[model samples]
Target: MCSTLPTEVQNAPQIDQDSGDTIGVLDCLRLNVYVPNKASSQNPLPVMVWIYGGGFFEGAAGWYDGSYLVKHDVVVVTINYRVGPYGFMCLDIPEVPAFGGDANSITVFGQSAGAGSIDLHLYSPYERLFHKAIVQSGSAKVEGMFINPDYSAAINIAQQLGFNTTDSNEAISFLSTIDSHLVIAASSSLGYWFRPCKEQVFDNVANFVEQDSQNQYSPARIRNTPLFVGTTSDEEYTYDMNEFAGNPFLDKIKTHYSLSDADLTRISNTIRHFYIGDEEISSDLLRELNDFKQDFHFQHPIDRAIVKYIEQGANVYQYIFAYSSDDSPVYHSAELKYLLSPKFDPLDESNKKDLLMSKCATTMWTNFAKYGNPTPESTEEVPVTLDRATVDKRSYLYVDDENGNLLPLTSLPRKYQNWGQDRDWNRGSGVGPDDGVRIDFDNRTVVGIRIDSENG
Candidate 1:
């Protein structure tokens, strides 16, 4: 167990705030490396780089302890990258230096916004720095994930900071003089408005727009990188629904997406029919809303990404984390506690199953890091050797305790079967092997849904 001193970068800009002076960018970027007690540089074990997530606004490397993963004979690295406006403001600056390591044996993994960062890196010119990736509950294709050519939010943030100039260059110059803490404070208040933007070149760093135009998982970009992507069964169980309730929420959606008044009313009615049919906003309705949010934000985008990778002939593994305690029942980021921490108590009878599940998950993760496949060897209880995801198979590993082992799901879930029905973007298009109904994207509600006769 070895840790490095946090070394500040030279020429780092400072921001002034009421609290104190803070660096515009986190100058004290550090990488904490952990290796097994028996391992050494000569042996050169496989490396797993963990990126933490806090909605792209707040997160730190120190939050995650990789000691448990290191004990599995792999090198675990937790790194610090800039977050919010300072990190992703689309400014012309020196590129964030890459970590020095064996690029061939590196696997980059992260959860939520961290996962989104990995997606950006995967499409970056520096993608060759890592060999594989694991994206947990996030994707670049998700709506609003990448802010393309839209400096309005950033300009708004600067104006809020009392830098009212409209000229991009002048505003940026003034912003550089402000305190970093104040900038972050404004970003927090603005929410997801300040995030990574597309089409911007920073010191020749690959911009997101160019990469996104091409197939994200194509061999041309990713070079057939193996990927493990998944989401929790109840990813949005903890979501605060106040943001999306009532007419104001509808108005915001309409304005943001440029949805017409007619389209908004139609979509609202459809949403009500699917998620709140004949029910008040009760506990059951909340559950439905949670599922809808999860599916729309995390699950659907991730599933689409996985399918794209498979289509591009890249090795991919998909999973749905269903293991949860009786109290929490599979909330977002719940898997992190189990996978990262070794303090899982075996004495607690209620959590015994979770403890076992954690061990299995860790083993699979490390195995994938070492080898391209997750389950290279079969376990005794389940005797399951998980298959590589393919366009034909579309196989997904369902991680739960019911069978005490990984179970393969070949068919699309019922909810996902008609996924394209309500989606205005992918309307009139069929996904997977099934010839499902194709609906058109129009202003009218209840767009014609045509069921494939063969499947029906």
Candidate 2:
């Protein structure tokens, strides 16, 4: 069975000169390619590049093993770019002349910081190499701008470790002189959450926040490629370390915002207004903290980008991961198991059902990569009224409850609107300390209910 599995590796060529001195030019230019052993002869296998995300601080090409996608008849490419301040920091260096070359029609995909990089590549002045972009669990709103203090701290730390960042001519040159680990360590101390600073306008791609509606750098003109955006059920669960409950970072945030004891009670409110399209923070007290984190970081930001893409008349699709397990902590990257293996869970029939849902997800994703649409009915997942140019009927894939069940994306809002008619429905009845907000169920109302009495 192991010998029957098929995969091959290749290197993609870079058509540009290395101006920065941080990493070797050969290392900076090389990209790893995972090819299918049994590619369709009539139509060369569609490509799906994976970009691993570690908050822009940690991750490498080795982190993602693309054998699964390759076995499914897709070419997977993972490339290494300069990371942290070295990869992203702008030093106002003179522009190098563009290497003359034709572009390839490819689809770029990534999660977290990788997702932001996809967005950046789409808008880069250098001609893009991809025809579609799949941004998973990352949005430009938070990633579009870097905090000035964080940037300064990163540079200062790099210098302390003896890496240069000041002189444009010597910066990339000196970077190549130092060990990779040292530069990474110095950048890590300043924090892994740096974004491109909006105040210092560099180029259109780096200046994501500065690009306005009227500006040519908007997402509408950023890329003429198909788009796929998604997020995990609980994106931040992995980051919650109980040991750091009283960490200095929390104290610093509280002081910066002047947060009082009462403010913690309404922390959701601040997060909502700041990130969730000004949606009202749920008034329910139970589980407010979890819901707030979900809204600001995952749900709200992803939703905003999806809507924006739809309004622009670009091809798009929206999805929510509703499958989870009672035994598993509802945390980030939990869905990876479902995608990587058929037997991700086996203890119960419910786990078996989630396996089916995982199949539906992979099917939709591969279908979109091959056809430029998730399904035949929709090229983009946009709102009804927001779509004005031509009626591009949008549909969503809802892997609901158990099994590979799917429903129209619009059914969520319809279910919400009609919940009052159901006699068993109660909006605020089960409200409790951990129940979070009591609300009518739509598609977004995902819960991993415990069925076993022993677990209960």
Candidate 3:
């Protein structure tokens, strides 16, 4: 057994909501392990590791309490990885995936940046690290801004703090001496973020990424790895919708696909016309904006990755979180609250559906970890059998209380890739009402009984 790291507050930075003084302890790499009561030396339980999402610049392990999943008899591990400059700071230090991925039995799962981490791992030299993966709301096929190759942000941050250093050594040295929290705080103040960078191949140093992962995504490269990939119906609804108004997919389209200037203009104009017509914008801009963001960031990339996964003969379980409220629609990271602990557990009779949905989430996740399939065989808890994506069609488990109409992938981005407007929901995207399409029945698509549970 490995000895544990020191107990310290999360290595957080100054963000919009969270202040650095509160939980921003720096360079703390630790793991919180919650083992089941039944887990013994003789009877070892399966393990589930949690990687929190904070756009790669923020987040800590303490945010997610794994005690809820431990009730189901699996060992849960939540780890603290350095964030901001510290997360990607060049040092002779290290860490995967013994639990991140071990035999074919292990399943690596995460949400947003955490999910994006899985994508990085898949594209890196470590693609074979996990046999199966559960990517909730992120993939490597992101915009250029997220993945930078230069150390300009680090230098910019150093200059912003106090030491107006131009040399890389001087910048890193100055930034290193300050409080980890301050470096992060300074980064925020400067509006500069040091994200994952593609490294130049050095002889001895361990490299996380050598080539741009966004450009490296391909079925031939990823090989056959079972995937549990999904996205919420309205992936942008939970955020300030205004953020997406002017920010369109055209920029991502330019970088994602190397197109000529003439071709790029034609595609951009077509996208603008299809999604948001006229420069004044439409009244349904927020609604349409949500759809547009979903398609660009989450929905489109996920489909592209899924197409590759299926092409490589990987068993892929796809889904869309359709549950939402009047206040917040089913958006990015919507399905996470139900999967992990530390969520608002409403005991009132009016919220029975929420409780049942939570149960289904935990069971399906644990099921996926134990068995390669999310629903190897359905039980009272998980009533429906989730089919995997095949070469012919894309099968998905729509996690919603109402509506089962499929959002045909072909309906999106006609000029973007000419992937064909496949409006047919025959095999991969087919789901009759009998296969647990709606929630009016006894939570048919999921599995769980309100077994009392909570976590610190």
Best by lDDT: 1
- The C-alpha TM-scores of every prediction are 0.78, 0.62, 0.77
lDDT of 1 by residue, 1-456 (tens): 533323332212223233344444547477667666555445667889898776665556666667656656777887777766767676433211232234468898998887887877876655367888888888776655765545665677788888787677776777778777677677666653446665655675655445552135445765477888888888877546584566432453354355456655655544445555556665546677776666656665666666666666678887888876564668778778766752332223257776676667787788889996677888753356777777556677888777565787875565544434323335322322123222232221333333333332
Q: What is the alpha-carbon lDDT of model 1 when measured against the actual structure?
A: 0.63
**Alpha-carbon lDDT, every model:** 0.63, 0.46, 0.59
Off by over 4 Å in 1: 1-25, 91-102, 152-164, 189-192, 201-217, 238-244, 247-256, 275-281, 342-351, 380-383, 421-456
- Global CA lDDT of candidate 3, please? 0.59
Off by over 4 Å in 3: 1-9, 13-23, 89-104, 126-129, 144-146, 217-221, 238-265, 276-280, 325-328, 342-350, 403-456
lDDT string for model 2 (38-86, tens) is: 5433445677766666555444554455554454456666666555665
Local error of candidate 3 at 4, Å? 15
Judged by lDDT relative to the true structure, which candidate is superior, 1 or 2?
Answer: 1
Give Cα distance to truth, residue 174, candidate 3, Å.
2.6
- Tens-place lDDT per residue, model 3, 31-52, is 7776665655566556677777
